[model samples]
Target: MRVLAFLDGTLADPDQAHLRVDDLSVLRGDGVFETILVTDGRPRELGPHLDRLARSAAMLDLPEPDRAAWERVVQLVIDNWSGGSEIALKLVYTRGVEGDPNATPTAFALGMEIDEKVKRARAEGIAAVTLERGIGTDLMERAPWLLLGAKSLSYAVNMAAVREAARRGASDVIFTATDGSVLEGPTSAVILVRGRTLYTPPPTIGILPGTTQGDVFRAAERAGWQTVVESFPASELTSADAVFLASSVRKVTRVHTLDGQPLADSTELHAELAKVYDSQYD
Candidate 1:
């Protein structure tokens, strides 16, 4: 439970909150966030995470973040925290207090110990269920304000999806478009492996671009694997040699079952991919 926070250039106790009541992020979920994995007090793929945060902020019409300030604050938190070998570093930026049109965006960085559950999932694998997101693939382009491509604080829906999966006796969820196109996981990017080809959904179809997935694909490419960005139906998942949900904090987690049906047990592929993942971070 060790936690530390840097709020608006000042270090603060995370237990003792400092956010205002009128902050739009609290009131309307108008904000963007990034969660990076910190190993031995160093954040992995930091630049890409910050780049995504800036892009998300832009989508929300919030002012650009002070990247240097965020980097310094994150490093400071990592240095001062007493967490274990790995930590989850989260950066958040809000639209600020309501009614104060010129109010500065409320930004903060929080660091905490990584969850044991996340580690276990990577080690043992998980089962998922496909759920319809009830939106068309091109809806984001037609309705830009829906904030589909942005990783905003409005995660209640995603949280609900995971809960629904749990109630159905599953550990996670893979959301599909109304037309049954596999989009992504609730909180991670979905990657399907077939033989030597790795497939992932493209961002243009309204999925959040994943920094961890990009790193993994690049590493896989160097290891003689082909990377392709494309969308396929949910049924395609069960046919793949292996399936995984990748994110900065969780790293890589294999999916062994979807809707209680067994998927291809590609332990060999998983081990090979794990080698690539470890080599980069280690």
Candidate 2:
């Protein structure tokens, strides 16, 4: 099932939902967006997603999102999603039509059923290869114009990296900085497990702040595990007790292999973490 709603909290037929060809989101990729995982009709970690959306908009010099209006649209989508037990809910805000002096921002909410492939990856884990991000970790501070930490609509580089991973016979990718620091996945946050501690790179390193990673850390802390936010070298990934890629729709996915090198089997540990992770949705 699919659901669509506009910023005004009015439902729209999915087939009729449209955007102008001149919309800046199409013309210049000038927009911000968030993908949230909805379970049992409830959008998970919604507040954080909205918070990040506002941050992205501000970073792009766009108007601040009206939170209450967006929330209403989300609820409207959820009310219309009657068949799916899980939904990949996306919120998008774009600078409106180009060259139109009176154009206002365009915003909408869409919810669709989660793909079976995503479910399989979450359950069976995935193999990934590391790719260099071609920039140093300090570039974000050096060039703020890059919008490094914002979840903007310009994702060509990210998509290209994913394609590169596929060409290399891998299902996903982990991006590393020129300084050899582990960064993040093309569409997810990278998490490394060592003994009883969980580690993830800090958002200061030019990666989007991950909502699912935050939830995973909270789940770990509640389960008596230590969690650290710091930068670690890419070399550490292969040596870690376990590695995971966390995202909203995929949730927590273990890395079975990195660059075709088999990672240590941590099924028991993964189960423990997965249980804790799912409990957050409860």
The Cα local distance difference test for each model comes to: 0.89, 0.92
lDDT of 1 by residue, 125-169 (tens): 898999989888998888889888899999999999999999988
Q: Candidates' TM-scores?
A: 0.97, 0.98
Superposed Cα deviation of residue 127, candidate 2 (Å):
0.7
Candidate 2 residue lDDT tens string, 1-282: 788898987788888738889999999999999999999878889999999999999999989999999988998888888876998999999998999999888999989888988999898999899999998888887898999999999988999998998898788999999999999998999999999999999999999999999989998999899999999999999899999999999999999988989999977778889899999778
Candidate 1: regions farther than 4 A off: none
Q: Which candidate number would show the highest lDDT if scored against the true structure?
A: 2
User: What is candidate 1's CA lDDT for residue 69?
Assistant: 89
RMSD of 1: 1.2
